[model samples]
Target: MIGGVTAVAANGPAVNVSSVNVTPTDPTVGETVTVEVTISNQEGSNSIVDVSSIMLRTTSEHYERVEDVGAIAPGGSLTIPITTSFDSAGEKNLLAHVSAASQSNGSRTSHLRAYYRPITIDVEAPEIDAGIAASTNNSGETTVTLTNYGNVELTDAEIRTAVDGTQRDQRSTFDITPNESESVTFDTTNYDSDAVTLTGAYTARGERHEVTRTVDLNRQVQGEIRLTSVEVTERGTAISVDGEAANIGGTDVDSVLVRIPDSETVSPASGAGEFFVGSVDASEFATFELSSSVSNGTDTLPIELTYLVDNERITTTQTIDLSTASPVSPESSQDRPAATAGGDGSAGSSGLPLIPLIVGLLVVVGGSGLLYRLWNRE
Candidate 1:
């Protein structure tokens, strides 16, 4: 055939990868790492097969493959972009191969030396803040807020409460992104303790992060003096007393002291105990309870109560006025005054207590976060 007039050629040509450039070089784990492969024909003029549909193998187990990229032309150029991310940090080797059946398959071959950098991500401990109660509700709650202060995303967080180290309520496994915070509640209605320690943690990306907190579930019934039944036979009358005390934080309090009010000066009716309930956790309501113990005569009496919560002493003065205990008074009577506290509700409240999830630990094995030197690329 060639002797007649012209000579024929066999294969087209081969391909060579030039420079591999990643726009935003250093990116955090779970973030998109765009891979741009610059390739061109090295030998003769042949149609290049878009072979972006490639695969990658890494030293760590925190990566995935996206899709096949298009082909590159001979002597010409083509940039195929691939988006990827990692769970752990380490080294990874990537490759791009063209199929033999494609136009530039048998003739072209390309390879890349990719170094997946090392990323340090730690799941920080859960942060907790507690205070005393503010309202008069016999039963109340405390609120505990859990914040994620890590550089990575967290999932499946769990929170639990304990009274004197006894598990009361628990919430399990929730999701949260970095810098975000969550709140959990615990009711101390039926619970009574001097102090309580709250311990919590969570699981994320197959690792566990743990954290604990200490709080004053301080409930010290020091004296025999207490407010008994005092009802409203009349219209303008109300009454209430302390409900329960629980540990809302992570630490335990041994003993709490309340001030002894002067009963002679402020009327025998005015003055009880002292207490402080900080950062209400579960049942954080303060509505007083009204009981009947009237002589059918309209009268008024004052009382004082005190307590220490979260290292703070609080004293409250309350008055129970029996104005209309007659027929009309019995028909129209007011309920108890409300109790106020820091948290929405965690413990020591009137309503039913609630639970929440707390996540904050990790596993440091062979190459998890310890080997920052061997895997990172400059």
Candidate 2:
């Protein structure tokens, strides 16, 4: 008891902090860290409780600060938990400190700083994403977009696109930051497929990552026009013609022109021989008129048709034969060709007009025979 005049009683109401414990000791940036501090009062006097302030601080490079704690009783201890996080990477020093005073004595003593295990923080790595989209117009093009959707920047990124398993285009971009995007285009007119895929690869923090995406094809408005029917009227040396055109393709056509092209055998009789058919909707038909003159021996004529598809002009030519039509005299009562159209059943005539000539010959022969007989009898 002589030596026990005693070490703890000699100093009195002394306050000190126990070792600190940090949870999730291995933490990445933006993650939470929990700090637990234990404050102890070593005094034996029950009436003289120790009042103390406990705080947590870092030596230099780190983010760890807790609210000061107060009021600890003699022969008692208190433990407090606080949450914190670090914004940067690397090692950080954590320290806990406590300052104390007692009612039995007015002296305040500062306890030695207690060090905890160092914290090593790791940063987030770069992430990349890719997606594909396809669109077809008259020119037939498909565009693929590669995006960096992650929170970090990537370097030396390469992107490749394919349609129906066939490689179409490939490109590379450098230092693509988060939210940045790049595009690659392929000619889909001849691609002949509805599915498209995009693949991208990049290097980040000495690691390589790859991403892929697939999309269906989207086609824009398109139009297709075709000649449906043609009718030819033989008016003396000139011919009056009417034709029907149909929109057989995907979209509607705004304007269509139908005409008989000038040749050695045929020429525009009255107008330019070209007529506008107006708008033709999908699966709809429009009519056009043309007047042309033909030479005595000419039997073939070319018909030219023009229309628009996706703002592009398309021209088509068709040949029709008129020799099969029966010859019609202006003196006869006939107005149109007696034969049916040949090519595509649209409008050219076939076969000769022998009915009118045969009738006239019979009447002339009967009349002539009667006159000759009467004259002989007289």
Tens-digit lDDT track for model 2 on 124-167? 43234543344455556766666777655567888777777888
Candidate number with greatest TM-score: 2
Clash pairs, model 2 backbone: 230-346, 230-347, 324-351, 326-352, 326-353
Over 4 Å off, model 2:
1-129, 192-194, 233-238, 249-255, 281-283, 296-299, 307-313, 321-378
lDDT of 1 by residue, 92-193 (tens): 444432222135345534532221222222212333222212111223465555667654556677776777678877766457666676667677657676
Off by over 4 Å in 1: 1-139, 217-378
Q: What RMSD, rounded to one decimal, does every model reach?
A: 36.2, 15.2
Q: How many clashes does the backbone of model 1 have?
A: 99
Q: What is the TM-score of each predicted model, taking all chains together?
A: 0.32, 0.49
